[model samples]
Target: MTTGQRIAAKRRELDLSQEGLGEALGVSRQSIYKWESDSSLPDVDKLVALSRLFHVSVGWLLGVEEDQEEHISNDLSPAQLKLVEEILSRYQQSSQLTAEQQERVSELVEQKVRESRSPRHRRLRYGAACLALLLVLLAGRSLFARLKELDRQYTDLANSVGNITYSVNSQIGSITSRVEEILKSQNSLVADYATNIQSADLASNTVTFSVRVVPKTYTEGLEILLHADTGDGLVDVPAVPGPGQEFSGQITCPLTDSITLSAVLVDQGTRQTQLLGNYSSLYGSSLPAVGISLLESALLNIPRGEDGLFHVRENYGFLTGLSASVSAVNEDIGQSQVKQVQLGLFRNRALLFWLEPCSRPDNHHGFEKAEQWFHLPSVELDLQEGDELVFAALVTDQYGRQIVTPSLPASRVEGDEITWFSTSFDFPSEPDGWGLAG
Candidate 1:
């Protein structure tokens, strides 16, 4: 029966009017009307509450089973009563089980009789004892099922909590690493600007650069040395005291010569090598060269696929060509400009795009721009693992210096590509702010 019909039937059986039932259940008369009219389901908690007040099992109240008026008291037969009395006597002295629990005990006894009886006699004598056995089996099965479901629920809860904690911790670690990097870069810049030049020029007469290695954690008594490449071979710059003691030095070189400097961080605590970095230049020299550069240090390395197998999803959108250049503005101060960069290609919803014009002509800071749009035609990209796409943005400083993020580390383009798979498609028009002419 529908929920509405069941509610109405139950009310009639109890001889209660809609208003009386509503008042008893702490609901308005209209709520009673709504329940009887099938407008909505009663809340689960409210249903449980009503079952208690009416002294009826929730299953029977919900019309899952019939309410037997003839068996209102549910008295047992002579034999059944005798067994029940025995079960109760035994239970009360040890176990405090209710009438329901006794029903389970009756089934257990009936099942034992069935198991020991002959096949011919089993069919005929399948009486009260057999009934009791059925009840016990049902009770045991129901309890088992409920326990299993509870176990599953608890496992799900634990996994969900673990995932949340892991995500939170990962975010915190990323933020801490980024902040530490910024602070170290700022400190180096400050030292370069403030420290007095100890000597004019030393060693190599090649392209001049500086390598700064900042420890994730502070350590005492660490020394840094610079490595340079002469035409014959590479040589190490003289050892210098680190910034831990507030020490700094200067080195100058020729324009054509190439050199690299590695920072070997020594831990005074354990007297062991703490960290070893590839030779990197903070100035003039480019990165990913014969030696590593500062930009490499800034990049967060995402491990690539080992087997070179990657699932590539279909491109259900458009690929717009790079059209215009816009200046990246500093969000802090509107007038204070930062970098000039170029816009990379874009797809519908800006799926994949590149940002160029990273550094200034002076090479001080990177660029930032807000709310720029680029328009392009719909195109499908069938990319594989290890395939890279270059993105360029415009970074124009006060001096009109244009810089771009190097092409070495670009977007790794790949997804699951299945041909003959049908997908819905629509074309997009150029919006007002984004266009080929703009």
Candidate 2:
């Protein structure tokens, strides 16, 4: 269908009279008639308004798509869409337009419905039509630019997606705990805490969190924090120790996003602080999937620190030597050099199999490579699917001089609810000290 045809169809679907539609779009009834007759086009702003009123997309209203759900406000609630539709239905039922007003509306729809003939283009006013077409083209370019911005916003969020919804988070914590137990890792002397997050339904627009904090050494004034920029800014949820204020027990807070999930203990004597546990990563634009359904997916987050340097951290994951492709923002693609892409596999926190992408000359930066596949097969070592692994996609910028960037952990979700890990990301800069993992 033509753009005008789609608009007419949606207007009818909303039970809006031609006069009503024209009033909503701030256009004359004749303009609506011309649009329906395909004699002229509505400007982009009117198209956007029509789409919003119909709960469809501008592209769909303009016949560019049959249906498109990926709009700028994709994260907006579905209930809002339904509410608009209901309100429109009620308005149509009770709306009372004056007899004179009804007569003022041109019965252009009647002409099309009965005769079913396309409107003849008037030769004298062709210039006006051409001008309208130019405006539409300009509007299309603006829409394209808007789409690019949305892609950048969403892609950045996807890279930072962290572990789990409710079920998935509990499962991962349980499995990681088992791994720690089997590894027999030394007891943490600084700070130790268990993290859990909960949130209300979309209607409530509220989130709740709970964490268990324990203090080993720095006993006095010990506390836990689980907070992040929950769409607004960095919100701190102060969770204190359980009972006896002795640095151990559950701490709860009704705060925002499942942010950095850190444990900090303070010395009562000197007020010194130690970062006991920090499982921090960026999150995707949309709230992540609820549970194991997120398996086999990948996420990356580049949370810039106050000092303007990317902090370094180690990570663990499992790999099957399958199709492993890492993504990141290329600050300066021309000068950027992805020196290495490494996947370190381990069992019970012990390194087992290590893999790296093959190198080619003059091709250190493979951003334009046909494929982003890396394989590391060992003849003497046997690999399992659930083995703990850490992925690091290391890239450096080399202008006339080369500067090393900080290293961060990368992970992926397994296909069958296993072997999932987070994607690693780092800022593109020449760090004074780049302590990359081996």
Candidate 3:
């Protein structure tokens, strides 16, 4: 059934009149009618609100499944229930998951289940803990030692949380349906992929790049090659999602003066090399369209992909081609202005990053723009994990200085994935501004 028909059906199921649902949504009765009659479609926010009001999954609302009724099991344990809710919520927000992504998410859920099934581990650990306590009691160790151990454990837990956040940040990409085409450079054929820098650890002397490749045809023994500008030797790693699958991998190469990166296809049965493409990082961002030296950061959304990573779906979008050299602007002092920002997702090293001119609002103060959610120009992205949002501004306090205003994180309402970075503020008490853009 269409979303409209399902809306009408669910409304009847809830015994709510058109006016009643409208009142709940804070919209007029006409809006509800228009939605039901298929004259118009509700945006992502409305879809989220409708799901909560009706107590239905976003998948059902989006017609991902034929049956709309929810059959939640009551016998689930607390952790299991929470895990199921999270997975289901992710599904509701993102229906554009690929088969590989679906499988990865399923594996995560299964991993949780497996962890839960290991009751003996907890019991054995408890027994070991009791034995250790008894030993400590007999060994005449000071209580101070135990306290210090506990403090060390606490610190470890805090570090673990940090690691989790970093892991989550590193593995986000969104999938968007787009016009299926290929980018043919001189030596390679490019399909769809996402390029974001991974956090480097001081312990490892290697730099890793996140490569997500979705190939339409089959190829064997795929290998990625990395070359430094210093004319060093080649670093080759095997490609992931090899065949009949989506490619997503954290490709690690020797950290030399590593500047140029490329990929090649090798036949599994026979060794032959076909060049993918070579990509170079744009260390400095040049925004000719906005006329501001764009500051880039990877602190965007961790939009989950079908493969349980964060990625965007299309190749050619706003991120392609610099349109103008002059950054155009219409300024005003009467009130603050929220400039239009252009964003891009590159596959390899991209240098140019820019944000529109805007004021940074107080984090502990209030919301930025009146409308918290803005639809990304790329509609094909089914937000499974996250898309790290990069906002550039025309502020020229100092050219090339990084200005990353702390904005709210992305969230899901009903069926739509809503992000919360705004360029305006409503706080009147604190009459102050940060960043050199304004």
Name the best candidate (by TM-score).
1
Task: State each model's C-alpha RMSD to the native.
Answer: 25.3, 24.2, 25.1
lDDT of 3 by residue, 37-68 (tens): 44356665676678668776455666565544
lDDT of 2 by residue, 1-438 (tens): 555556655564454545568799899755675565443566655655665677766555554455634243222134533432343234223434345422322132232222322244222122223323333344445444443443443343322221111122223223433543442245564434454444322223333445555555644444444343343455555554556443333333322223344444434444333333322111111121010111112222322245543232322222111112322111111112233333433332344455444333253343332233344342222224343333332332222222221112323223322222432222222222233333
Of the candidates numbered 1 and 3, which has the greater lDDT value? 3
**TM-score for each prediction?**
0.25, 0.21, 0.21
Our tally of clashes for model 2 stands at: 20
Q: Clashes in candidate 1: how many?
A: 31
Best by lDDT: 3
lDDT of 1 by residue, 1-438 (tens): 544555655564464555567788998755665565443446655565565566654455444446522112122234533543454344333433457766666555555444434343332123333433444464555444433443354344333433333333223223423543454455432222121112211122234344444444444655544444433365555445564554334444332212333343445644322222122111111110110012211112333234443333211111111213311111111121333334544332232544332222333233222123323223345445434433233333343322222211224433432121111122121121123222
lDDT of each: 0.37, 0.37, 0.39
